[model samples]
Target: MLLVLSEQEKTSFTFLTSLPEQVYPDLVKTALSQLLSTKQITKVVNSAAAKLKVEVASLTNSSLYVLSQCLLNSAKRNLTPEDLTSSLKACGVEVTIVTPLVISYTENRDILIDIITRSTVQAPEYRSMEWRLECQVGSRSLHNTVIPNVLTKWKISDPRFNNLKTKETYLNCDVNTLQHITESLRAAQLELDTLHARKMCRNLARIG
Candidate 1:
């Protein structure tokens, strides 16, 4: 796929090509490492500029950020080196600059992919549900009344936390409300099974 670039990104990337050719490998390596790191992009760009004895603006922190994102996405999607080269060329990056970047990516693709897979955060998922029915025969204010209600507890697990935390939610509703909730949930399940909804989910997964 051809990688589309924003106007600002296109302008910023031009600054990348102007850097010394000898620095390409180190630059690409630094950019890739920074992508999987918590460090700020400015520090990386500024540090590179200092080492190269060039102005910080000349290094273009925005370009480095975009480069890192491109590398990360490409790795996540398992794009081939040839595919990455073409995509970068389509975006107007010089062959010289693309060469080292693509080389570094190819050499480290498996490692990057492993890191990404390990770092991925899964959305919370339903683990289990418990429900109970209760009948209230009478209360102090209403001596001769009956009320039926449902008490539900839902457990959800999130993989993002180190502990693999599970959250519990309690819900109380009358019979009528419980029926409505059941019907709504059934409708949602049917919607998810539809072709259109499935396709939309696939697209969202690819984007993510």
Candidate 2:
């Protein structure tokens, strides 16, 4: 899979989002990282953001572009943001940005050098019934980007090896778009303590 949100894209997206310039990069980077955790790879993989590694054509000119060629090339590789985020978590990546649940994949692999969303898996929350908050998120985006060069890594054909629904319960959005959470894991807004994005950018200029 190819990811578009570059280290620089994070910078630009931050500008667009109109978030504090100082803190925007962190937020954008965090948003991009989510894709790595909480996304699915179609027929080959299940919707469990357990682990994700993406490839990109290049990160040039303070801009970023990504091209994700589908591995399975499933006839219907339509994935939701929730599906992607959950899968990323199952592997190890954490997603916490405003989840953009919809992404498109190609049947054939190609080099995509365009801006792409950085997927993320949200920190787990408690169901409204159980009601807990141990899973509160810290970073703006779920991805860390501490490890670069996400491509060149091989993935399992199917993580499940076999698709089995141990607990059978129809999802709220199996057909239409819907993001559901078990009554046990509902949440209020996450409280993030951080610096401002705009200020940080200015600081970089001062140092440079």
Candidate 3:
């Protein structure tokens, strides 16, 4: 996923590029070596910052971006902000704003809610309780069903979904839509449970 960097963050990128070409590779190597030895992102980052003669907090955004790229390269794939943060925590870094760098996948979650509520998912004949979502991303559109099992679906999408990297499409929009539908269904199920519990209580009262 691409980072939609803030204006300040964009300006901060110059700090990274200003370093000598050789220094960049050496810095990456040092960070990786430190990570392997100490298994702590903080130490790896601290060591790199010391080499650059900069405080860790002063170059937080630039340093974390480099570290994030390292993690992604090692993993050989893309990671969500949550996954990236978890990986960093496992290595002992505590950078908080890394998540805000990437735009939220759930930003348009309500639009999907609006679409579903306007559809026939809740109609009398549609007993499946699932809605098929036809989403358009640029010239390419995909058809996916909103189901309760999103974790499984996301697993499937992990390897197959390339639209995320494309400038013309929003892959997370479809994913978020499915996740929201799952949540709404769960809420509806809980309400049904409560009503059933009340009905059972009324039946027992009449028997007594």
For lDDT, the strongest prediction is 1
**Order of all candidates by lDDT, from best down to worst?**
1, 3, 2
TM-score for model 1? Answer: 0.58
Give the clash count for each candidate.
0, 54, 1
Predictions in order: lDDT: 0.80, 0.28, 0.44
Span of ten consecutive residues with least summed lDDT in model 1? 57-66
Q: What residue pairs clash in candidate 1, if any at all?
A: none
Of the two candidates 1 and 2, the one with more favorable TM-score, higher being better, is: 1
Cα lDDT of model 1 by residue, 1-208, tens digit: 5445567767767877677888888878777877666776777777888988788765656656667777778887788998898888898888888898898888888988888887877778888999998999999999889899989899988566733899889999998988898899999999999999999998777565
Off by over 4 Å in 1: 1-3, 33-53, 76-83, 117-123, 127-133, 139-141, 153-208
lDDT tens digits by residue: candidate 2, 12-65: 333334322343233333333433435632422211112222222122112122
Winner on lDDT (1 vs 3): 1
Cα lDDT, model 2, residue 135: 27
Candidate 3 achieves a global lDDT of 0.44
Residue 106 displacement (Å), model 1: 2.0
By descending TM-score, how would the candidates be arranged? 1, 3, 2
